[model samples]
Structures are given as structure tokens and as C-alpha cells.
Target: MSQFPPPLRQPEAERNPLPVPRPMSGRKVLLAVLAGLVLGWMIGMFMESIVANTPNDIDPDELHRLRWLLAAAGALSGLAIESIRQLQAASTDPAYRRRRRFRP
Candidate 1:
């Protein structure tokens, strides 16, 4: 008796292909932005606290300003990073290359 059965090959239609990148949904986009904002806020608070003159703490007024400024900056950077990533993914796709090459 054979220890194992012969291996079976998958059909072309059933074979797995490389995953294609898709655009983020509205909810996913929101989550990405929110994650960036929170990350920036954390970093900003840490840096600000580190540089503070009195007892290593930031002033309340400065903290208020940092919240908005850092969050906005982070959101912009996050969106930009996502765009670059998407572009890279599209560039690597065969269909995208063909379409670009034969554009009218």
C-alpha cells in the first residue's frame, strides 16, 4: 500500500494568483487616517513632554495646539504614503503595464 496518494494539481481556473491591490473603502480610509492621527499625537506628546522646561510636562495651551497640528500633519502624510503604495502596486501589475503601454 502507498504511504500517500499521488499529488493533485489544481486547475487553471482554480489556481491561486497573486493578490491584486484594491482601493480602500470609506470606512477603511477613515480608519487609516485615524490611526495616523493617533500615532502622531502619541509621538508629539512624548517629544513635547521630553523638551518641556518644567517637570518634563507640556503646557495645557501648547498641548491643545499640538493635538490639532500634529493630527492634521499625520493624516496628510498617511494619505500620501497610501497613494505611493497604491501606485507601486499598480505599476507591478501586468494589466496596468499593458494598458499604459498601449494608451491612445
Candidate 2:
């Protein structure tokens, strides 16, 4: 006599999974890019304000350097924001959830 119950069988359709989801549409990509740019620009402006309000004197050369630094910071922040948006989108996707369930 078998001590354990037999394994339940699932339908063929359930056994064979569908292909992974396709890439994001162009519109979504564009939107994500635009959102990131806006966020980065806002942060850059805030940083500039902080620098402007400092008590110490700032030289013309220092001001030029600050502009470059601010630009780079803004670009990097924009990239980070875009990545976060992508991550959130993926997490909420039903296909993504299904794929995750099958992963180790």
C-alpha cells in the first residue's frame, strides 16, 4: 500500500508556460525618459540654490566648475530615476510575477 497520496496533475496548457513578455513600448520608454529628465533638472536646481546661499565667497572659476558638476549630477540622477521607474513597472506586471514564481 502507498503511504503518500498521488501527485495532482495539471492540464497541458498549464504545464507549458507562455513566452516572456515583450519589451516596453516606445511611448512608455519616452515617458520614463521625460519623467527622469524633469526630476533630475529639479534636483539640480535645488543643489544650485544650496550652493548660492553658502556664506563663503565663490570664484568665477569655481562657479563654472560647479555648473559642470551640477550637470553631471543631474544626468546621473535622471538615469537612476529611469531605472527605478522600470523596476516598479516590472514588479507590478502580471507576466513578471508569473516568471518570478518559476525562478529558484
Candidate 3:
């Protein structure tokens, strides 16, 4: 019998051979959501004001619906913008390099 014991298992990083995703912090997520909410609220208020001042007559229900739509659009835009920024940052980060890295 050999005197030496069996070799220990390789580390997970070496064994997996896959790049692990860096975890995002809660603060970043919370800030993104807050930004979206604020943008949505501001857009809603602005649209409501414009609708209120329009010369042409609009139905009350229609105006309310329009306001909600505008707010929703703004919120979605904010979220999209935040996501893009995060993705860009991640791609540029020096830690991990992949073949599909984003350009421009």
C-alpha cells in the first residue's frame, strides 16, 4: 500500500471552470427602485398638468387613464436605464473577461 493518502479535491473554482457572477448589493437594487418610483411620479405629475391645461376638452376618466399610462412608461424607462448602466459597469469591470463582452 502507498504511504501517502489520496489527494484532496480541487477547489470549486478550479473544478467548475465557470465564471461566477458577482453578487449585486441590496443598496444598489433599492436605489434603482427608488429612482424608478421618483421618475414615475414626476412624469405622472407633469403629464397631469399638461392635460389639465389643454384647450381641447377631455373626459375625466380618459385623463386619469392617460396619467397612469405616462407614469408606467416613465417607471419602465427608469428601470431600463438602470439595468443598462449596471450591465455596462459589469462588462467593464476588470475581474472577469468573457468572449461576449459588450462593446460601445
Candidate 4:
């Protein structure tokens, strides 16, 4: 019998061990949400001020709709920004790169 014991099994550290994402820090997520809300509020106030000063009168319903639209846009933009940051982090991480898509 060979003197050497079976080589100790080493865990492979190639790529993402699990596809499912683990929970991230809630504080960071909360901060992003708060920042988005503040930005949305500021945008709403700025739009109101602009509309109030405009020479042409806009329908009240239309003005309300515009405000809502702008707020929604702000939120979506913020989400997109956050997603991009997450993607960047994943791309740059060596562990993540192992699992990311490969070029042919």
C-alpha cells in the first residue's frame, strides 16, 4: 500500500460558489433609498417653481401629472445608478469574474 494518504481534498475557489445572492448591508440600501427620495423631492420643488414662473398656464391636472412623472423618473434613475454600481463591484471582484459571462 502507498504510504501517502489520498491527497487532502482542496475546495475549488474558481467562481461564484452560489448563484443566489446573499443579503447585503441594509444600511447601504436604506441610504440609497433616502438619497433617492430627497432628490425626488428637490426635483418636484424645482419643477413646481419653474411651472409657477412660466408665462403659459398649464392645466392643474397636467401639472400634477408632470410632478408625479418627474418623481417616478428620479426613482428609476436612482435604481439604475445603484444597479450599475452593483454590477461594477461584481465585475471587478475576482471571485465574481470567474462566474461572469465569457467571450467566445
Candidate 5:
């Protein structure tokens, strides 16, 4: 008996993997954006409710300003999250050659 059985080769479909440089799927991107929006909205709503329930000693004008500030901050955070996702995708893209070509 041969010590080793005949090599079992995988089918061509299995040997070579699918396409490379896979871009971010639309479904995944949409889900990520939706999650970010929902989370930001929930946080904004929570802060607003807290400010509304605070004692009368709090300044009403300040509360209004706080809402604007929070809104901007939330938007920035969402953008940051999306940026990170894009960066990760770019890093894995096969077409993203690490070697740079210099032009005089």
C-alpha cells in the first residue's frame, strides 16, 4: 500500500479564490450609515430630554446652544466612523499597490 494516498486536488473553482479588490458592499455600507444615524439621533434626543428636565436654574439660551453643539459633534463622530471604514477597505484592496512610482 502506498504510504500516501493520491493527492486530492481541489476543483479549479476552489483552488483560485474569487475576485480580488472587493469594494465595500452597498448593503454593508448602508447598514453602517443607518446604525450611525440611529445612534447619533438617540444620543441627541437623550441630551435634549435631560436638558429639558433640568432645574429652572439652568439657562434656557445655553440649553439651545448646547443642542447645536451636540448636533455638530454627533455629525463629526459619524463622519469619523465612516472614514475609518473606508480606510480599512482601502488597505485591503488588492489594487492598492504599496510601491509608489516616482515621476520627475
Candidate 6:
């Protein structure tokens, strides 16, 4: 027999490592939504400043409404991003993979 001992075997996790996706926690969701809303509101304000170069160019009340619209859009975007993340995580699951369809 040779002087060298048998080689050690790697554990199951090490042998076939699988990439795991972490679920978005509530805190992350809240932060994302808040960040989106704030950013959107800021953008709306910037746009308003640009459009309202002259006092009579844009109505003050309409600007307020515009801000709300932008904020809503931003919030929706945050939700969409989170949904995509969840979908990607689900797609990695064995069950989901089995049922998932491939595009031609």
C-alpha cells in the first residue's frame, strides 16, 4: 500500500452547491417603496420647475396632482421590482422548474 491516505470527501452541500435566493423581507420592501416614492416626488417637482418657467404656464393645483401621479407610479414600480425578485426565486425551485415552460 502507498503511504498516502485516502482523500477526504466534500460534504453534500459543498459537492453540489446550489444558488439560493433570499426572500425580500418586510423591511426591504418598505424601504424600497419609500425610496421610490421619494425619488418620484422629487422628479415630479423637478419637472414642474421646468414646466412652470412662467407663472401662467402651469396651474399650481395641477402640479400638485402631477406629484401624486408620479408618486403612485414610483410605488407601483417598487412593487413590480419586488414581484420580479420573488418570481425569480420561485423559478429556481424544483417544482416550479418542472412546471415552467420554455419559449420557442
Q: Which candidate achieves the best lDDT against the true structure?
A: 6
Best by TM-score: 6
Candidate 1 overall lDDT versus native: 0.71
**Model 1: which residue pairs collide?**
none
| Per-prediction tally of clashes | 0, 0, 0, 0, 0, 0
Name model 6 segments beyond 4 Å from true.
1-22, 93-104
lDDT of 6 by residue, 6-62 (tens): 999999978865557676577766777888898889989998888788656667899
Rank order (by lDDT, best first) = 6, 1, 3, 4, 5, 2
TM-scores for every predicted model: 0.50, 0.46, 0.53, 0.54, 0.47, 0.63
The TM-score that candidate 4 achieves is 0.54
How much is 5 displaced in model 3, in angstroms? 28
Q: Tens digit of lDDT per residue, candidate 4, span 36-65?
A: 767887788788889889898888787777
| TM-score for candidate 5, residues paired by index | 0.47
Could you tell me the C-alpha RMSD of candidate 2 in Å? Answer: 9.8
User: Comparing 4 and 5 by TM-score, which wins?
Assistant: 4
Q: Cα lDDT of model 3 overall? A: 0.69
Candidate 2 vs candidate 5, TM-score winner: 5
Which digits, one per residue and each the tens of the lDDT, describe model 2 over residues 21-103? 45545566556656655665666567667877998776757765666666666556656666666665656455555544455
Cα lDDT tens digits, model 3, 1-104, are 99999999999868866444455555675577667767777777787788789888878788778767766776677667777666655564555454576899
Least lDDT summed over 10 consecutive residues: which range in candidate 3? 90-99
User: Model 1 compared with the native: what TM-score?
Assistant: 0.50
Model 5 alpha-carbon drift over 4 Å, by segment? 1-42, 92-104
